[model samples]
Target chain A: MQPVLQWENVSFAYDGRFEINALSYVIEQGDFTLFFGPNGAGKTTLFKLAVGLLKPAIGRVVLGERPLSEWKTLEIAKYVAYLEQEAQYIFPFTVEEIVLMGRFPHTASQFWDRKEDLEVVAWAMEITGILRFAKRSIFQLSSGERRKVEIARALCQKPKILLLDEPTNFLDVRQQVELFETLERLNREERITIGVISHQLSLAKNFVKSAIFIQGGSVGSAGPPEAMLTPEKMSEFFGLNVSKVSVL
Target chain B: MNIMNASNSNVIARSPEGTTKQSQIQRLLRPQLGSRLAMTTGISPGKLVLIIVFFVAILFVTFLVSLLSGAAHVEWGTSEGQFILMQLRLPRTLLAFLVGMALSLAGAVFQALLRNPLADPHLLGVSAGGALGVVVGSGFLIAGSFVLAIPVLSLLGSLAAVMVVYRFSLRKGALSLYTLLLIGVVMNSLFISVIVLVQSLVRSDELTTVLFWLLGNLSFASYPRLFAISVIIFTAAWFLLRQARKLNILSFGESTAHSLGVPIERTKKIIFLVASLLTGIAVSMSGMIGFVGLIVPHLARLLFGSDYRKLLPTSAVLGGIVLILSDSLARVIVIPQELPVGVVTAFLGAPFFIYLLKRQEAKRVI
Candidate 1:
């Protein structure tokens, strides 16, 4: 089978200043790919392109052998779910209502949420351990809890691929561990393709199968995490000291 | 390894309990039958019941007061009283109700679409459009024919103003709420100036009619005009209610609505068109009744939640009742001479509006 996601020589720019040069990468089925870069390295922009939210200035984004432009957004939504970094709740919707919105593409009409839709939402919530907060207003939830609810909403779509942008940001240490563990379990058990953009190298090293290091809007290295994430490469790309120390 | 197995077994054993607890919680969280019934029509049962009872009571009292307490001071159930009630009070009451429903419903839709608590039909240039039309129509008014010219010109003017605002405010196929509001304010000011210029140019005799119309009197409301306005208001209300779900999604913000497959452009167009029509019709029927639209929707939101399903219908019904009571008081307050219904609405609604604002601030602070 073709790679679950492919970015071929993609280029993007915003307002003519910050630009992402020609970039190419492939994410195989069931791969936990971590995209590592500093702030403004076009991490969010790349995710946006992958999810078809933004069109590349050059080249193309392909999913399951189909070009991003060719697939209807609702159809694409069935295969890929995007969790934005900011989990802002603009309306006073309950947690259940927000989760049910994930099933909107599958809903027959705007008026009703069917039994199957509720069941899927319930399952997603259960997996995220947010089933107990179903009736709580999203605005009332803590940042970590709201992020979990957002992930639950993405999972409710039953997408084959998940794209997350800084999912660990604003989360407590325990919450971060819980989220990473959840992602690991989902990837291993469900065989879901996952792409995450993160600055946390330690967490990324533990979870991701591969790494793509981006610097100055261009790929620095793309290979197996163990081989690509060396001390010298880390120092060169991030301009930081790299040292390993025993925990105990 | 033994401890891991034991913990794993504990997790498996606790699964049924968790499921049972969730089901129980779900049952408790489910809305009651009364709430469900309320939700079906897009308003809470408690508010609906209160509105229905208030409407009936207000209607009866206003009708009785309007007939008995006018300049004629006609006794209840007498021949003169019956004639006044049938000929004047009844039509005025119907006009008040229709205008109130139209303005309030329009206001609710405006607030939802703009996502601003301060939005109202009058604030968005529709009232000024109607006022300009009425002022222009006054120039063509023949003796005893002011009624025909007023509604026709008012409706035309309102439609024209709305079209101008909408055309100018749209950018890249989307209406920017801020631009729309700014254009509305400017257009309204320009239209008001034109109305003033027209009022100055009219003959002294026509000036009284124009001034009364501008002040928004329902004293001239006939049975036929009342019937026409009633039909228009009810039709507009039904159209808005049908689009309630779209409004609900819209309140969540445009991008989210679009992602959920709601055609944002089409929905906005339909809402703006229908809401403008309702405002125009209301303004044409009763000259520039302010604050009913501005205040009633907020009141409804406070009484019920911000859910449009409940918000729209409740606003409409409560709006009608508020106008009826206001109109009745307008007629009876001075006894010999009546006050303008617009003045009454502003007088009553402004205080209620302030109270609501303070309450909202208090809620936010807490």
Candidate 2:
């Protein structure tokens, strides 16, 4: 199968400081991948490039066999969804309405949601376990619930590739595992490609099938969990000790 | 476990109705009436009728009170009273109502687009821009006949101001709230200073006229000119209400809107221009009336909820009510010497604004 996304010698800079330098990676179709890095290690920058929110300074970022710049913004949105970390909203939109906004790219009119849009929204909310809170104010929900709502919103867009930045930030241990399990279910059943930016190094090995370890604006390694997350490699990338805990 | 296994097919495959569990719409059980109404559709037909009836009843009473209680005393039965009602008070009240509607609707939309309840024409420097245009281009209206020239120049000025402020405030195509407000304050002062300098340069005979223009009032609008201003204000307001969904989408956050395929930069520019045009119309018609936008929009949100489709028109009506009441208060407060309507609005609006800011600050501290 063709790679769903590729970055070929991509380099990006902000205020003369390079964020992503000469980075190359190929994410195959149906891959549940972790984009693991320390803070400011260009994980978010790469995600922005993949979603066409930002353009690279040097090389091309490719999505589905075409250059990122070739697609219209709405067209790219239809194919890829990017959820920012801590998606804060101003208005008191109810859960259903917030989820329905994800279908904005699919409809002809910006205002009206069609039947299919409503159905998709219902399903998205249902899957995310927020169908019960459809009428409740999003502001009233806890951070973990709000994060779930955000995930439901991204799901309603019907994206082929869902790129989330800091998906596990506010989630507790159980919620974090549940989130990954949910995404894993979606990845297995729907074939939606997942590229999540996460700093939770220990959890990525248990939940994700593969990970891309990035350090100093370059991909240090890319492979399955056991191969890429060895203790020495973990120490090298994160400067931390890792020991296996054996269960009796 | 059951939900996890059953939903595993992943084509969004389960039929909404056939499923044993209730769909979201059916499961909605919010306690508040407005929220419950908001849950079903943007505006329920029954509630819309209720809103219309309430607004019409209140509007009729306010209109009657405004027409009958002006300083020029004539019995309601007399021809003299009829003349005042038809000629003087009627037009003034209508202009007040129209200006109020324009400013409030603009405020409502601006608040939505900027995602800040504090967004207003006066605070955003739009009114100062319009005032600048009037001060510098004094005879643009040609011997004070209430033509379209003033509104046109004012619109141009307001749009320019918004553009300048927007460009300065933009950080990566989004307006940060602090930066935008700070620049707006600086630009307002800058533009007002220019207006003062222009007033000094003008012939001494025109100084009172400039002063009257600076201190907003509603007494000068003729019926014919009121008709023209009405068309412009309503047409612009209608155009804005038509984009209600876009405003709703925008209020969430620019990135969310963008991720949902909204062209962020273009939407921002269009909304900014329309909102500025409304401010210019309000300014040109009746100098810089403060707080109609600030007060009326929050009132509308209280009644109509946050959905812009319902909120915009409701704000327009409530805005009219507030301004008509304020203008009437300006007329009858001291019994003879009429207050500048803008002064009354500021007096009413500033306290409420400070209160809102205080509440916002308290919330942050909490």
Candidate 3:
């Protein structure tokens, strides 16, 4: 499969601190990839670079074959949808309303949402199991429901590749299982490329096909999950004893 | 559980009465095209349109009621009474409505643009700058056109303040909210000090007019002044309305808005300038009406959901209603001794605002 997203010699730093230097990686089409790393490992930064939210100081991030700099931000949004970790808001927009916002890149010029836009939004909500609460205020939903709402929103964008930063962060075990199951179905059935930043080592191993291990600021390893997430590798990178952890 | 029920049989469609007996899969596959705004807000477009029209009708009725009732009793049968109705009360009433609309709309836009719930028109210090312009401009001859000089000078002053804030608060191409608000507070005090210095320098006779204007008096509103302010205010409002969707996305936060393809800095700057223009015109016309700009948007948000598309128009109409009623009360409450409308708004808005906050809390909507 062709690489859907590629970062070549990418380097970025915030105020000359917290740097990611000479980091190169690729997310191929139809790949269910896990961005596995510890805290402050620059996984989120790499996701931002992939979505073109932040430009690299040294090198280029390419979407398909074109450099991200060549694509307009709005045009980039059409192909790559991003969901930041912890989507917080003070407003009381309904679930459907929040989901419908995903179509903004397509519907920005129109005065109102067209029929197809509404259909896509409905379909997204349905698949994400948020259809019933479509008219409910997002503020009223639990964290799991809210995550599903946001996922429905990203799905509504009909993006070729969806990038989520720590989507399972606040979800419980059952909800986590449900979320992973849904993601697995989407990857296998819809064939949308997926890149998730996660620390749920055992649970994510079941859903992810390929795992990209990031340590410090660069890729420590990248391959199938079984090879990459070995006991020795987990102990080495995450500093966690493999025997102490209990799996559900 | 709710999702299961929805996907099973009771597929929610356009309206309750119109839910066709279609499978959930088919329904999701081809949803009907209806009012998109209604689809989001759960209020149909026709009903939403009617709600806006009803509020406007209420505003017109309040306008007529205000025109008829004031401190001076007028006999409808007499030509003198008709003259007072047509000339003085009409213009003042209309000015109050327009100023209210300008302030409220500006407040709503400012809140959205700053992404701060507490942001108001005066938070930018534009009003203080306008006050300074009125005080200093009053002293100039300006080809003996004192009337034209005041509004123009105030407009220039507010724009100057905006330019200074815009220039200083921008850090590395993006506007910093903390810096913008900090500069605003500093400029407000700075302008107030200059106004006091100018006030001491002016003759005693001119001092009273400037002081009364500062306290928010509408006694001098005339037809020409009213016409000019209305034109500018309506145009600015239309411009802000065009930015409603982008403003809605902006409420999601700056990064999210940018990711969704909103030109963040450009949108922020354009909204800032236009909203400042509204504030400048409002201050130039009505002096510093304290609570209308700050509290009226909150009231509108409570009444209409936090959607800017609805909030903008609702705030305008509700602002008009609140100010018109307050101005009428200001005229008659003291019986020939007029309290400044600004004083009444604070007195009225505070209690009513608290009451609404309590209700929202009870509903758990906030």
- Listed in order, the DockQ scores are 0.22, 0.40, 0.44
> Which residue pairs collide in model 3, if any?
none
Q: List ranges where model 2 is wrong by over 4 Å.
A: A108-110, A113-115, A241-248, B1-50, B76-78, B137-160, B166-182, B195-209, B351-366
lDDT of 2 by residue, B235-272 (tens): 88878876777787788677677777877777777777
Q: lDDT at B133 for candidate 2?
A: 76
**TM-score of each model's chain B:** 0.84, 0.79, 0.87
Q: Provide interface RMSD per model, one decimal.
A: 6.7, 6.5, 3.6
Cα deviation of B116, candidate 2, in Å: 2.4
Docking quality (DockQ) of candidate 1: 0.22
Q: Which stretches of candidate 1 lie over 4 Å from their true place?
A: A1-91, A97-103, A108-126, A130-139, A152-235, A238-248, B1-79, B136-144, B193-220, B226-232
DockQ for model 2 equals 0.40
> What is the alpha-carbon lDDT of model 3 when measured against the actual structure?
0.81
TM-score of 1: 0.77
Ranked by TM-score from best down, the candidates are 3, 2, 1
Candidate 3 TM-score, true structure as reference:
0.91
Q: Which ten residues in a row are the worst by lDDT in model 2 chain B? A: B29-38
Candidate 1 C-alpha lDDT tens digits along A216-237: 7788788888777777777777
Candidate 3 RMSD computed on C-alpha atoms after optimal superposition onto the true structure: 4.2
